[model samples]
Target: MSKSLRTLLNEIAACRHCVDNPDGTSLPHDPNPVLRADKSARIAICGQAPGTRVHSSGVPFTDPSGDRLRDWMGVSEEQFYDVQRIAIIPMGFCFPGLDEKGGDLPPRRECARLWHARLFPHLTRLDLILLVGNYAQKWHLGKERKSTLTETVRNWRQYLEMREGPGYMPLPHPSWRNNSWIKKNSWFEKDVLPRLKVEIKKRL
Candidate 1:
């Protein structure tokens, strides 16, 4: 009756809505939606849109930020990229281009609006979802999200406890740009990471 996960993924791969028509209009550049998933995955990484390296590689989190994320999750590159173990989805499927400040633009809203509900239902085994960055936190947590990123992440335990199905954990983006934020938040390394690793190990 329902399409298989592979079928849905193939449809996602072929999607051109963001480039062909955005906001019921058009995108400035070609679309290159990047993501990975499998029904057996136990963990989901909901991040922001792809960056330059990720866009070029067509692999989500194939950059320094991924290095740090793996470190935080206590997973190696091999384990992190194993689609059977983890699903890597972003708020925006494609890179949303650059902003005037030279930073990557915010994720295109159309992506989640169109794909997440369809995709997530198929990840039948997911036990935990790591919400990385502001966009993901806002979308997933809504009014439950704290006023600030730092506060939301600091309060990860609340979300984890309140989850109905797959437990949710808010995390700051692992981008090198947030080096100062990591340094300033010593408790994250001391407290949150240990819990995150334990949960990951249990699911794996």
Candidate 2:
């Protein structure tokens, strides 16, 4: 028999591989792995690792970016947070630390390598996975994704039409820094967000 989701979450919370056994330099700070999920959920939001604010708050998406994401999905805070309906899992469960310029580094490779294969199988009800940003898209879409983030996101319809397992929808990170990108990509707001909102409502 397989271990329960609760058991897997416990192991993830206590993980120290990034520190005790690092690929390069150990994590700059102690790990506080963060993620949310429930086996009944039909939707998953997979983004990059936590930023400074989220690391401090101990909650995923506790910032403006989260606000934007909620808006994109056309869901309120209460709906977005209900784990029974939606799961918020990042590529990295912890804050991977910042660079010299004060920007966050990429999500640790170990997270997916160690946990995703185990964790995802347990989310038996998942029907839609929203891959937020390049890292999530890269990992989830693999070779099927286009060369550029814009291209992959622009070609979003094909991903939704996928006949295999869960349907994937690629999205740009909701960070304010990408306000310019969002402005330039008018089609996303005009086309993709409407479809996203409909999907979210159907699942809810």
Candidate 3:
């Protein structure tokens, strides 16, 4: 029999591979794998790695970006953080440190490669997955993904229809940095958000 989702999550919580053995070298800082899930969850929020604030807080989506994400999902803070209702997993579980330009570095490839496949099969209750940001879209959608984030997200209906079971919806990162992107894409608010809310409501 397969390991229970709770067991896998415990393993994830204890993971220190990223810090202790990243490419055979130590990380710049300690590893704090920040993710949460439960077997009862029907919705999965697959996002990028933890940002500094999230890493420090050890909670996923605990910043302004999280606030925007909750607003976009039409969920309150309580609903968003309720692991029994929603699973919060990122492409990289830990912070990968900052880049030279002072922005967050790309998620370390190891976490997903090591954990996602193991974790996904056990989440049999999932009804919908919110693929937030480019990394998540690329990982989950593979060749099916459109060339650009805009195209992929614009074609959200296609992905939702393609899956016979758990529906997939691609969304942009809710960071303040993407405020302009959100402004430019008026249809995202007008068209996608309503559909997203409907789906979320079904699962909830």
lDDT for model 2, please: 0.94
Clashing residue pairs, backbone N/CA/C < 3 A, model 1: none
Per-residue lDDT tens digits for candidate 2, residues 101-184, read 999999999889999999999999999999999999999999999999999999999998899999999999999999999999
On a 0 to 1 TM-score scale, where does candidate 3 land against the true structure?
A: 0.95
lDDT of model 3 at position 102: 96
Clashing residue pairs in candidate 3 (N, C-alpha, C atoms within 3 angstroms) = none
Local accuracy of candidate 3 as per-residue lDDT tens digits, 84-193: 89999899999988978999988898889999999888778987899999999999999999999999999999988874678799999999998899999999999999
Model 2 misplaced regions, further than 4 Å = 1-3
Instruction: Write down the TM-score of every candidate.
Output: 0.95, 0.98, 0.95
| C-alpha lDDT values of all predictions | 0.90, 0.94, 0.90
Candidate 3 displacement at residue 174 in angstroms: 0.5
Model 1 bad stretches (over 4 Å): 1-3
RMSD of 3: 1.8
